[model samples]
Target: MDKETAKNIRESLKADCSNCFGLCCTALNIVASSDFAINKNAGTPCPNLNDEFRCKIHQNLREKGFKGCTVFDCLGAGQKVSQNIFNGQNWRENPEIAEKMFSVFPVMEQLYEMIAFISEALTYEVSFSLHDNLNQQLEKLQNLTDMDADSLLSIDLVMCRFPIKELLLETSQYIRSELSSKVFAIKKGKECSGADWIGKNFSGKDLRTTDLRGAYLIATDLRNTDLRGVDFIGADLRDANLSGANLSTSLFLTQMQINSAKGNEKTILPSHLQRPYHWI
Candidate 1:
């Protein structure tokens, strides 16, 4: 019902985008920001992309004037649905396949977005009971996504609209229920007592059972702190500072979870978490 609990659930439901294809980058139209020149389309590869499927100019994207690119998140659809599902099939070459693939593209994208909303909704304790129900829905959605191309294309778009709308309504209800709650602001300065900080400033803070739901830790400095059982629901951790946080047994942190958090050279993270090339 409160903010803390709602935060954790949302973190999990955010799409596991690493298992996705780079669809949005290759399929949609994106104009260069102040950091770079030249506009591109969804199916067109950005000049920065290399043979490795990574941005060649990632490091200089900002300095080179492509600041907008840095903030873009495809919700993991780039790899999941694009490369994985389509198997590197680009609509540009085969105009015949373009229509179906393009149609399916937005469906999966919408599904991914809905999953994110539901993930955020799950963070609210009020939605705890709804977890099973939502989980079932998620499973159903995943199954739908896994269907063959023919079946996927045949799916009713309206079906997704209802499910997504319903999940949003429930999440909104949960958030509204906690309107009177106070949010915790994890900072870079002195440590807050009873707070968990694994390998971070609060490295010794006893945040073992702390509720860190929906906390906006955007680019905050974190290193060498205890994260035994911390909940990281709905935390907009984009570009946050995680230098030495020990997240061995962290709660609710999935592949997508780690990807969303900020990490850098000095960041001591779990072995499995690959630091985004942009960070290095």
Candidate 2:
């Protein structure tokens, strides 16, 4: 794929809150805990949101106990809902549509996430064989994104997610299969998924092609490791050290995972994901 297409794909998925109506802060609920500073129920506007549809504490969110906001990304779904679905109409101006708007937001969020995954798969050279399939799915979802609020709410998310997930898994395997043999080999016959590995030290390990799905890796030391093609879906990486690690090729690594983890300047990340601000 050309560099420009790849750049456009990434830009389309990145969150653009300025064009949004602060849907995340209003449509979703937040609890008073480590993640959020205060409690808020669904459909209620966050007190921190200002008249300009901007977070008042945007700069000091983590410091103010609203760390959840820093890691959350709607993947550009907010603007699509605000501009395309409702034509710039917000709940504040017309409170009657608040519930419908909130319901449609989550559906669009999941749809956009699938788009992000498929878009990422298209960028991989090893996944070239699946480019046609990914492109078809991308176009379909892009069309769905342009639909009105009623149509978006009617989508069968279960049916839509299953096929996309299968495609993603297959694409991940294709990429992992092509990795060089010189890389560290994952342990054979070891329980790859749902393993409790919290606080374990895996520093500088060769973890290529590892099936680490649903694994509890909280506070694990993964510094400078070769993590190419490792399936990180459902892995808990809270407080994990990923300094100097090569994660550009990791599979299913989401922004939530990166946001919850610890990383340094030496950590190599995928093009679509950004480093967490809390990391020094």
Candidate 3:
């Protein structure tokens, strides 16, 4: 796929909450924690969700102790499930299908997330060799979204994600290798994949080409860091300071990750990502 086509696909994968029926607020379970004010069960609507299927605390989610709600993104699965799958019928109005709709939501979420990653992978010129495979996988995922609710529920997400994960890793390596030079390497340590760097001071460091997949970077100081070409898939960036950090070319950095972290107006992000509303 070409860049423009890939861009369009990525845009479609973003959450359009206005067109949704509050699936994220009703379909998923919530655990009481630092992020959530109350425990909620799956298939139950949040107390804060109003009659119009909107969150009453939409603007004050964090202050109201629903921090987890702010960090969650369904990757457009909510609307897809609400409108496309159910023909605009909402769970509150159509009580008979409520349980089935809730069950299909998480499955759709996984598919959309995979599609988002593959769509991004296809945009990198360095990963052109994998473009054919990526496009095929993307097509497969798109087709899966069109499947009936029962078919969607039957999907084994583990099996579906295995190949996509391998492809993303390959794409990340190709892009990073093409962009990063020896000067961008970390001098002290060679490995960073899945490393536990919580609360570590890495501010202003050149972290280019670092394979930081699944790294625990919670509360880590990364302010003003040069992070071009770093792979951040599954990295715990909650409370990690990103003020003035340059991630314009970072690999696999998602909106959810950015939403969970802290940043300032000086922080640079990829062209496709939106700066969080809370960022100063």
Candidate 4:
């Protein structure tokens, strides 16, 4: 596919609540804990879900103990199941299919997540060497998404995600290698994975192309840092300050990570991600 076509596919895979039927609010259950306000069953619709399929407390989710809702992104699976799988039928109209719909929703979401990330990888110039292979896999996964609900439910996500994860890791390594050419007297060589750095100051540090996987960075300061190519897949960023940080090209950074961290208008983000509502 051309660059523009790939870009469009990436954009299309994003969460568009206007086109969705609040599937996440109904299909998934939540416990009364730090993440949510109350306990809810899998098939039961959330009380905050309005009749119009909109979240009543969407704007005030953080204040209402539903911070989890603000961080969640279905990656376009909600509308896919609501429209494509069931022909725009909802659980309220057909309660019989609710259980099956809920089951299929997660599977489809996983597929779309892969679609989104793989498509994004294709946009990077470093991924050109794997373009043919990536395109072939992307097309195969897209075709799988079009299968019937029964077929979708039978798919083993573990087996499917294995090879895709390898591709992404390879892509990240390639980009990191390219970035290593730029010289800078910065703290660029460090293995801080699984290390406790909570409430520590790292402002103006050069962490480019660093391996920070599975690191504990909760409530840490990272303001105005050069974070390009940093591996933040499993980093704990809760309450971490990222103001003016250059994460626009960061590796493996997700919406969940961004939501957990604190940033101002100056903090740069990836092209496909939206700024968190709580961010100043």
Candidate 5:
């Protein structure tokens, strides 16, 4: 899928979190962060993950030093493959079938990567012909991704490894420099508001003076996406990875958005800017 299309799918996904089964946190091997010192095996739920499936340590993950967990984004793996495909059966509640679910998780994760990449590819006008090819691949991945755990585990691991590796490489390429030829120009100055562009590749695109107020830009690859002079007022920046992103001159950056966005020690904030209160 092209970049634009990928973005659209991702945007719709954020709104559907409640439907997810919390699969990644409960069904995969995760080395804990400060808040959670222990690593968890596939099919075992994280202790910090609460009954509601929300992270009990969400707010204090880092101060509590669970930095490793804080950076994770299943890229909506929980909702798309787990909730929608498997009908929300997570490994935690099905230990007898835990191995089956664990085996299927990576398979679905690879597919989720494809979905995200294809969605990104679809956004560009020049990639129109790619639509059919992407659709085919997406359908195939979706089929495997949505399979019942029994069927999912029965697949040959040796045979499936090659395809997953190939897909992962192809998907990675799109996130790099592939968009230079299809650079975006917001002509007609069409207004965009409250849009969800999380985990997308809007890198290096000039979004100066754009109105992105209240948009959900979580984990978006904005490395070089221009934010020289835009309104970021009220945007939900929750864990939106902004490393190397230039927001030094952005406008109306609310305390909430700044707090939600993730930054490192090297982040260059404009003078008079205050770090978010909870980013520790």
Candidate 6:
């Protein structure tokens, strides 16, 4: 796929709550914690979800103790499942299909997430050699999304994600390799792939091209950090300080990760991402 096409696809992958049926509010289970005020079972509508399929406390979700809701991003799967898969039929009106719809919702979520990653990977000039492979995978995943609800439920998400993960890793390496060897030498022995750095202070550090994939960065401090070309896929950034961090060229950073973290107007983000409303 060309860059323009890929950009359009990436734009479509963003969440459009107005076109959705509040699947995230009803289909997913929620536990009472700092992120949530009450326990909620899977397939049960959140008490705050009203008849119009909108959150009643959307304007004040954080204050109302629904922080989790504020961080959740369905990547446009909700509308796809609501409008395309089930033809706009909501679970409440169609009780017979409720269970199946709920089951299919999460499956679609995983698919959309993969699609989002692949679409972003396609736009990288460093990954040109892998573009053919990436485009093929993107097409295959897009086709899967167009499948019926039963086919979506039958998908083996783990198997589907394995190859995509490998591709993303390869793409990440390509992007990071463009940096000078001296830069890597400066941060030698600081390889943090999947490392536990929870609550660690990394304020004002030069972290260019760092491998933070799957890293535990919960509540870690990263204020004013130079994070360009850093691989942040699957990194837990909850409450991590990003007050003045520059992530303009970071690899595989998503909106959900940005939303879960704290930042300010001074934080430099990629062009495709929006600054969180909660950010100061």
Clashes of 3: 0
Any idea how many clashes model 4 has?
0
What tens digits encode model 4's per-residue C-alpha lDDT throughout 1-280?
7767887888777677776678899889799987798999987889999988898988899999998888787878888988899888878777888899988998999998888778877876655558877897799899989999999999989999998988877776666666666544343446566788899999998888887777899889999998987877668888899999999778777787888889999999988677887998
Whole-structure CA lDDT of model 6:
0.89
Q: Could you tell me every candidate's TM-score relative to the true structure?
A: 0.52, 0.89, 0.95, 0.90, 0.54, 0.95
- In model 6, which runs have C-alpha deviations exceeding 4 angstroms? 180-190
The regions of model 2 sitting more than 4 angstroms off are: 1-7, 126-129, 180-191
Candidate 5 structure lDDT: 0.57
Query: Which regions of candidate 1 fall more than 4 Å away from where they truly are?
Result: 1-22, 28-45, 49-88, 99-103, 109-138, 148-204, 254-272, 277-280
In model 3, how large is the Cα lDDT of residue 114? 92
Residue pairs in clash, model 2: none
What tens digits encode model 3's per-residue C-alpha lDDT throughout 1-280? 8978987887677898888889999889899999999999998999999999889999999999998898889989999999999889988888999999999999999999999888988877844558989999999999999999999999989999999999998888777776754435444223488999999999998777788999999999999998888899999999899999999978888999999999999999998788999887
Q: lDDT per residue, candidate 2, 1-280, as tens digits?
A: 5535854785568778988899999989899988898999988899999988899999999999998888788888998888879888988887888899988998999998888777777766644558777777888888999888899999999999888878877776666665534344433222377878888888998877777878999889999988877888778988789989999778778888899888999999977788887888
Predictions: Cα RMSD each: 9.0, 2.6, 2.0, 2.3, 11.0, 2.0
lDDT of 5 by residue, 194-231 (tens): 88887877766777556566687877877656565455
What TM-score, to 2 decimals, does candidate 5 have?
Answer: 0.54
**lDDT (0 to 1) per candidate:** 0.54, 0.82, 0.88, 0.83, 0.57, 0.89
User: How well does candidate 3 score on lDDT at residue 63?
Assistant: 98
Pairs of residues at least 3 apart in sequence or in different chains that clash in candidate 3 = none
TM-score head-to-head 2 vs 5, winner = 2
Model 6, position 80, has a per-residue lDDT of: 92
Query: Model 2 — TM-score against the truth?
Result: 0.89
Error of model 5, residue 123, in angstroms: 1.2
RMSD of 4: 2.3
Q: Specify the poorest-scoring 10-residue window by lDDT in model 4.
A: 182-191
